[model samples]
Target: MHPQRECDIQAAPTHLITLGAEVAATLSKDGSLSEVLQICSEIIAHYLKTTNVCIWTFDQKSNTLTRVAFGGKDIYTASLPKTIFCQEDYLENLKARLLPCNFRNTPFSSRLYTLVVENNLVGAIILFGKEYFTEIEDIVLGWIANNIGLAMERFLAREKQQNRGETLLLKLASKLRHCLDFNSILEIAVKEVRDLLQIDRCHFLWYFPYCQNPRITITHEAQDSNLSSLLGDFSAERINTLFDKIRNLEIIRIDAVRESSLDLETQEMSIDLGITSLLLIPLKTHSGQFGAIACSHCNGSRYWSDSEVELLQAVCDQVALAIDQSEFYAQTRASALAAQAQAQQLTQALHKLQHTQSQLVQQEKMSSLGQMVAGIAHEINNPVNFINGNLIHAKEYIEDLLELLHLYQEHYPNPARQIQDKIEDIDLEFLLEDLPKLLSSMRIGADRIRLIVLSLRNFSRLDEAEMKPVDIHEGIDNTLMILESRLKGSGKNRSIKVIKDYGNLPKIECYAGQLNQVFMNVLANAIDALSEAEEKFQIQNMQIHIVTKMLDSDSLIIRIKDNGAGMTEEVKKRLFDPFFTTKPVGKGTGLGLSISYKIVVEKHGGTIECLSEPGKGSEFIIQIPVRAIASFN
Candidate 1:
């Protein structure tokens, strides 16, 4: 039978068995790239019966080769050319196929190589010895080559990520030492590092102080248009619950987002914003935090490394140092304020004070903004640190499974009965499919946390220009969100229905923040009225109708109407009067409507009035010039 047909010679079982036994140990996912590559060289040398086995990597910047690893070396050579691997003929050979070539200048010895890392043909094995192989031997060499390729793909990706993170930290630490401007610290740091990392976006989110929870707002953001903009103050409900990891200087990394511990709403919101994965590293000390440095991946998932985590922690240490240097004298600011106040001479101060007062007002607003941001940073730091700590273990687990699965296919093409049983027990196919979903979840979770911080940042934008075109609807939306819980339900268990009839209107020249406050006052009052009516009338359909439309060519109108007991003529007449309120004793400050009226009328060159009858609901009508120019200064 053999004489008749014996051409189907397969690779020996010993070749497969030897590779199977060593592959897992040599190319373990947890092994460092250098360590694995070195082991790979040693294994190949042992099998090929050559002591002159070496791995040489190419340097693209310079036409050079760098020896990464050598096996059973006893040959001393100071005459080796650095650019041997980068030569045109050498590259052509590598691209063509695995082939032998003359070694050095001697035809007596020979060399052959196979591609290792694919990134710019990063490296390859150089078998520097006279060798002739049978076809089966060549097949074994091919197997090792393919294995090297797979190992390089994973190891190099991780290595690249780790190196980038290290470079970022080192540069940031160095820059912090030389940075002189304390006021613009957040802005400068984020911009510099974001550019250096070549990431889609970066931000330093600060926590709001007045809120009881870890409510956050973004104070500084450096971003590209690759992702949806996250720039606004978000409600506390949206904040991520993983700041503890960040507090411990752990870095949170999300490689590929699919499913996560975050709520569905939050995940959806992140997807809406076009963020896929991100890294949140806390800039915190034992005492407190400066904020977190968020490196976002908008386009796809990216592997994060332990080296990257440590590097970020070091960077955070430097950030905290800078913050300490910058904010260490915060207590002395009060004394400085008192000194400035005493310097104000009455008559001289009046004119100078008017201009200075406007300046001071803006300064105070910024100061408040700064305080809120600082708190947010401190709050979000811990959770991000916590997430960072956990992510390492999670990644290792996933990598272990993937490595095991890969080895099963590569080494043991025909798995034993016990191995097959285990695979079936584990439902290997389903596990493979589901493993990636976990990463997707983590990515979604990280993105959700980022979105909250972004929103808060957007809400805190302080325009230097006194009169600029701004979205009034955005301001209203933010205000309504702040009071969302109150409107969602009342003491009587009745939900308030808010009907918004917004019309297409051009962005009006206005103070965006001030307008937001106006919306807050009006919306708050409407909610209060609805709550009262819900209790008094036991009404299930409490409603607040908000309408915004173009009043004329150059003006816009806003109307807030409540379905509650209406105000009488006397109440309506005194609604805009200072210190006037129909609310029961302690509940009524009465200045809310009065201040709101002044904002719409005197400040923005607008008109405001209450239109109501005693038994009917009340409607507050406001009209503002769309393009009116007013100098706050």
Candidate 2:
């Protein structure tokens, strides 16, 4: 709205203004690295009167240069590969020296500038032209390089913050997933957030805006051991003249509460309590906002960063979700209890009806989900198979092309200057050596995807949901395949090897789908326990052994044992109890083992038992009848 910028370069001073303004404008758009490079390259090339401008990032791990974006005529020509082979002697020399170098006047006058970030060579900016750059032009190029480096740093920081926020949210959701108790959920939410952010004090204040009492009552508080607790009620009526504004705010951050425009009493209280800064985020869901989370900094007047604010907001969202889930559970349990108080006959009738209805609903949902997975797998298989089928031909075509190029080089060693320069620019020698490796990598990736698709089809087993004589080992193997990633461990968990000892046995008559669910839940639990034990107790030798065999030829037995931090007898007693668990509030819903028990004992006329003691690992033994008591059509 203010003014429009001219596209042409005017004077030396004007060049600086134009370059600065263009780079600033591109950066302000916050598009992507490609857009920034494109705009900057155009401006730099225009000012320097260069024919071409390009940026190639250096990959230190592979010792290669990847061309990110470029601006010029014939930029996408076949004379160059997307990746510049850094094995070339010219590049080796330039990289070793870490300095700007220009080529002699041959096909064109070209110069290469190193883009260094934090003493590490991150990239290269190449400018090609008929005329070399003047000293003034070099100065302008340096200015552009500095701006580009700073912009890249900013972008990288932004990406890291975004990734961290995502990880934090995922962890919060996972930890609170099994939690049903309102108080327990609140405790975990406050403690998790306080520990993660290293905040001095974190408290959840319950408040209902619609109520006559605008009182903020602290339900839960997590603070440093040295810090005094603030777990009490406080009135908010006089706190803000515009209470609606505070209620609707995404986040209310006071960097220096002592200097803030908060009520005089609030400011005085904060100063007296040694609170430098504070952040209040309203906990909200689709239903309503019933509370706010207060995070305080007591050390000094801390500047609340945008990332920190976002993290707190995400944590508040998780808490709100936990609250909503807790309320839903309470309502559902109340309804079920009220129905249970009817006449004995009616109560039994209702119980059977509800159980049958629930079973039907669960089966329907599972069937629909399995159908969707099968459909997706079918759609993906065809395309992947097509790629795999043509992959060998691709390799053959590349080999033939390489052979032809080799023949050309052998016959005509002394080519024209233009052809020779083109060869060097394209780094054809490195390409010939790397072409097969690239093809092999693609083949490996395709094979991995195909394996994942196969695993999906095996695990779902939608057709085998009804009673059928199926191989139990196949179900176990499929579950293991799906859980392979968790077993291999990651940044936060330790790996555990699964030892399978299967005695040759005929296919057992049972519900294959239900048996598969049991295997998944049991195996998943063992892996989770081992992972937690690995981090907490620093246990290096973690293992889970699966043994299956026919017991007296009438029944089949399976024992799943793990060398993890064992549970006490008390835990073992309640291990199969419904809605009872030892896991953290949100981490477990206590239904996995219960379902497994019902499937093994009630449905299959089998027995399930858990044996464990402190310091000794837990073992779950499941025995099922092989010969069915009912006839199968």
Candidate 3:
């Protein structure tokens, strides 16, 4: 027998020391309150030689005792009272210092009785053995009561601690949900797990698909820098190899580790970092994928509790939710930014389109003015030319008439009328000479006035208002006539020649006034180009060529080619651009070609292009569609 058992047997006859020791050892080994009570009943029945042994736990709220664990030889077990005695019944006995054995008169048969301390009357142990109980047996029952009470206390403490941990985890989850930033939430989760579970090192590894590796992003690391270094280089593969056995399992706990259990690499790493034991938990989210959290102890191996695993799993859930939210916010912000940029680009394009439209309208107006000027100038030139020529002839005739008058006056110097009676017969010569002189001078003045009136009427083409089908050649002819005076001015003496290769063509539908303006602009530009040409040799062959042709479609093609100082590619490129001119300041508003371009192209759907090269002459081709454009109603 065990020494403690023999000492109990020597003390009392009824006591069974062996049964008491057996019960205590059973409770200690099992570490469970319910199992401890069952062992207590079995020990009393077999060793105390009792017919019945029943254990009842107290319900403090109901002030009653109820059978909780019992074992007995049948004496009609159904008739047994579930409640032995209430707290009120025990109150008087307890105050009078009467032993619980005094309650034997009631339905209960047990002799020895004890209270289970779970808030007042937690439970009781009733031992009914053979009569004439020995002192040793009484002592053994006392030991059983003490051991049961201690076991119940331990169970209650453990339960309370578990409930507290669960509550803490719930609070942490609530806080994590409120956070929008993934990193912030992760950091908090790591720290809370470490603090709550009292772990030495805690690290969260984020799985990166692109790299095929796990990144230790957030950590509540220990003080050892070497340990951190060891963990930093640890890869997902190595971790998998170490924990391969438990990879697919749930809640794996390694209570202890031997040096031989660690692979060579892990062992070496642990030596450097002074790590003794490690706990690796696969963090699973609601979707059922695995991330990992690694905790290590530098001092010694750790036995991780069930509560610790539960807490970590709770944190992992929160982290997954937070990360999802963060990604959603990022995508939403990016979409909004892209939409805003597109809107801005559209607005800018609209503004540019409006500006171009405005420029087109202004150019159209300038083209119209150029046409009217060309027409009026052409009409005025014909009369001006006639008047100018006649003026010179009239001057000559006047001089002759004046000379004849002077001669007649000298011949009949005095008293021609008195002597006229006698000399009347000779007056015929004087009358003839004087009358011829007077008639000659009057004819010269009348011719000059007629010329002025004719020039004035032809200068204004008031007859054509709206557009009409007209011969383009006639318009060119009229333009040249009007500009004749300017063309024949001192500028012409510089040897500028105009060549015309006008093709025979039928009259076509066109804005006659506008076409005339086109011709004037081309001619004027040619003249300007000729003037700007450097006087290299004798300025002889400065020529402007104008060609006109009728196309198969009844459209007209007018081309003006100049052999002055021809334009370079740069000049030709911008020739039709509005507000671009090479003419001297104030001499050109830069609208001539621009206006013509718009009128022919935009209004009539014609095409214009310049063909020119450096040192080579430039040709501007204008192809106007003969068909009138339909009006937009």
Q: How far does residue 620 in candidate 1 sit from its true spot (Å)? A: 74
| Residue 134 miss distance in model 1 (angstroms) | 1.8
- lDDT of the structure predicted as candidate 1: 0.67
In order, candidate lDDTs are 0.67, 0.76, 0.64
RMSD of each: 47.2, 42.4, 21.6
Models 1 onward score TM values of 0.44, 0.46, 0.41
Say which candidate scores most in lDDT.
Answer: 2
Candidate 3, 1-633: lDDT as tens digits: 358765865674433556766776777674456666776787778776666777766666677666767766755356556665564557446322222334344454345456545345556666554465655666566656766766666665566556667766776677766777756766676666666666667776543323556533333343334444333444545445444433453444544445446566656655565666666666544445445666767776687776667766666666677666666776787898898999898888875564475456654664454455556556666675676577568767866876886786788677567665755776755865676576566566556545444433333334555556777787777677656655564843554556788887877766666666677787788777766663543345677788888776658898888876677778888898767898789999777787777667876777888888767767889998776766600
Enumerate clash totals for all models, in the order shown. 35, 4, 14
By TM-score, how accurate is candidate 1?
Answer: 0.44
TM-score between candidate 3 and the true structure? 0.41
Candidate 2, residues 1-633, lDDT tens digits: the string is: 112212222335666767667877887676777777778787777766677777776777888777776766653234445675566464556533322223332466666777777876677877777686766566656666766766766776676666766776787798778889889888887887787667799888876667787776788999988988787766765554324544775577888887787878677766776788998888666577668888899987878788888888888878888888888888899988776666677968876675556456556766886788799888989999999989999999988988888888899989999998998998987887888899999999899889888877877887675677888898888889889988888886667888999988788888887888788889988887788788778888799999999997798899999988889878888787666778899998676777777788777888999887776777889998886656332
lDDT, residue 484, model 3: 64
- lDDT for model 2 comes to 0.76
- Stronger candidate by lDDT (1 vs 3): 1
